[model samples]
Structure formats: structure tokens, C-alpha cells
Target: MATYVNPGSAQAGAHGTIYREVSPEQLAVEQQLVDNVVASFDACQDPRLQELMTSLVKHLHAFIREVRLTEEEWGTAIDFLTRAGHITDEVRQEFILLSDTLGASMQTINVNNQAYQGATEATVFGPFFVEDSPAIELGDDLAFGAPGEPCWVEGTVTDTDGTPLAGALIEVWEADEDGLYDVQYEAGKRAGRAHLFSAPDGGYRFWGLTPTPYPIPDDGPVGKMLDAVGR
Candidate 1:
């Protein structure tokens, strides 16, 4: 059995218990497994994809071994992810919430910001966006007959040179006063969602519910996970 030396009196060049516990032969076998797995992807013709998958495998294996992960803990993790998948449907995206809460969405945005340097920073796209939302005219009230305070918003679509970009599509959406989306309500209900086009001068305006901070929908598995973790 490997042992750790007394920390208070250990000499120079002392190594941690990790180095003492893991034999060189054991470490070699672990490394060979990582290499073999990475090598299996060599048949991939795309260089970029090959690089990404290889790096992912290497790091994922390192993390698993470094944490001394147990089978029970791994099974629990699998269960959590399975539940996350089960609760997602047409109107709910627990996975996106998981990514957002974990900061993966923000990091991805940061990494891809170079491609959108001149555009406005955007919030992570939620599942609230629906196909074939009825298009409304400029200056229309998006919150008509919907819950919450009436709000008026205006903006102009502009290019990097400050020139107006006319006819640009402007889509807007938000949670209602109760933090629920339009799709979450019963049939024929609508609130906090719409789209319109910019005017001839690139200026656009609309009336909608006032902005209010709200918690993510917590009725799903992801919400419960966040709650349990005190997020």
C-alpha cells in the first residue's frame, strides 16, 4: 500500500499520495486506454471534428479518473440526465436551462461573439419561440388582452456603420407577470411573444409587457434540479 509522508516534516521534492498510490504500470494502462479510444476516431475524415472529439475524450477520461468517480455516483448522474431528457417536449427545454445555468451557453456565446461583433448582445434563446407566430405591424401592442403592465418599446436596426437596415425582422418575447410563457397557458391564450418588421427608416416600435425579473420555469426536472442545488 502507498502512504503519504508526514506533511510537517516532508523533505524537498516530496510527492503527493496520488503519485505514491498509482504505480507506473497502472498509469500506463490508463493512458493506453485514452490513446486507444482517441485512435479509434482516426477514421473520421473531418480534421476539425476529429480534433474536437479527441480532446473531449482525453479530458473526459482525465476528469473521471481524477475524481475517482464511483459507479453509484455515475448511475445517479445518468438518472438525472435521463430525467432531463424525459421532461423536454415541444414547449419545454430543460436541457437548455441546464446549459444556461451551467454557464455553457454564455461561454459558447463568448466564443462565437466574433461572428456577431457588430450585432447587439442577445439573451440565450429559450424554447418559448414558436413557429408561425402571427406577425404584427409596427407599433402594435403585443400585450393586447395579455397579463401585466402595458409597455411600449422602440428600436432601430442598424449596420456596423450606423446606417439603418430597413425591413429587418424584429422578434420579441418575454415571460408574463407570473413567469409563464404563452404556450404554458391553456389553448387560445397568448402573452409575451410576437414579431414585427422594421420600418422604412429601420425604426420599429411595439407595446408589450413591462420587463420584470423572473425565475426560470421550475415545474420541470431541470427546475427541480436547480432548486435542489440552491441555484
Candidate 2:
């Protein structure tokens, strides 16, 4: 038999107080959070945010129902999320990587930035982009002080009419020769890095050490989840 206690009562013993099971009111609070999110969207002026938040709530509620999740599983999930927050920092985004591996990032980008039919297809902007990188002149090498196989990356930004879009912003970032981005290195060096601007004719070029594929970071709950999934 289960015993009920006041909302704020404390339980004693090794097993601790089991507290009252989730009440109807408690479940209503959870559902209300989802409802509020949807209702708030109507007040949102930004179309993008409205669309995003609306979809987010819909899928989130769907997931909860699909799993028929238990209280223990929910508590474990909260713990995992807390740990993920603790592990995040200026150079690391464990949550973003989790989204990437789950295809959420790709889905968001694809949904928001539909292709223009003939334009280069956009892809996921992985968690390695660094803002305000030291700008370099045309044809300058971005490898900086790191060592790796030399490779040239050249492209042109152009308008739909096949004419180059000169002076377009062309920011480039990639992994080092060892398949690691500068943020991944603790030595405080910017290797296999670069920033270049498009020319008057939309042509842009820069040199950097060739990048190699590397495994994603595997030191958090997301990593554990991936391992469990045999990814």
C-alpha cells in the first residue's frame, strides 16, 4: 500500500519518502507548459521563432506520448540534461552535437534554408565555427602555425543570374590535419584556420591543411546515448 503526504512533507530513511504520486494538478502543470508555448506563439512577431517554437512543442509532446515514459526515466533524463549543461563551455557545445547526431540540426537548416534549385546546397554548420577569426588576404594560408597537408579551397559567391556576388562574406572554418578544430586543442593555437573575403568578381580562395574526419566528442550523456545506440 502507498501512503500520501502533504505537498511539502519530508520523508526519512535510506529509501527516503516516496512522496505522493503525480497528482492530476501536477500533470496539468506539465500540459499547461506545452499549451502556453503554443499560445505564446500567436503573440510572437518573428515568423521564424513562431514556426520553430510551435513545431518544437508539437514534437516534444509527441515524443513523451510515443515513449509512454516513466517517472524514473524522466528523472534520469533530467539528470542527463543537467550534466550536459555542466559540460558545455565557450569552445564545446555538447547539446549541439547531440542535436547534430540526432539529425535535428540538419532538419532545422533544411527546413529554414530551402535550396534555390541550382545554388550550392546548404549543409549543417557543425559546432566548430569561430566568429571574428583574424581576417587574411586573398590567397593567404590559414594553416597559421600548425602542420598538415596543404590544400587550396577556392570558390565563387554568385547571384542567381550566374554573375559573381563580389565582396560577399566568405567565412571558412574546418578541422586541422588531425581532424580536430582549434577549439578542440587546449594549447591555445589557431591551426588549420582562416577567414577570407570574396573578390570583386565573387572569387574567393584560401589555403589550409587538409581536414580529416574525426569522431565526435564522447565524454557526456550524449556520448553514452550514442554508445548505447551502437552509433
In terms of TM-score, the best-performing candidate is 1
* Model 2 steric clash pairs: none
Against the hidden reference, what TM-scores do the models get? 0.83, 0.74
Score residue 220 of candidate 2 by CA lDDT: 81
Which tens-of-lDDT digit does each residue in 73-143 have in candidate 2? 99998998899899888778888988899899999989988889588878887777766677899999888
User: Mind giving the per-residue lDDT tens digits that candidate 1 earns over 8-73?
Assistant: 543323233242244557667877999999999999999999999999998888766655568998
193 in model 1: Cα distance from truth in Å?
A: 0.8
List ranges where model 1 is wrong by over 4 Å.
1-21, 115-119, 186-189
At residue 156, candidate 1 shows an lDDT of: 86
Note the Cα lDDT for every prediction shown: 0.76, 0.77
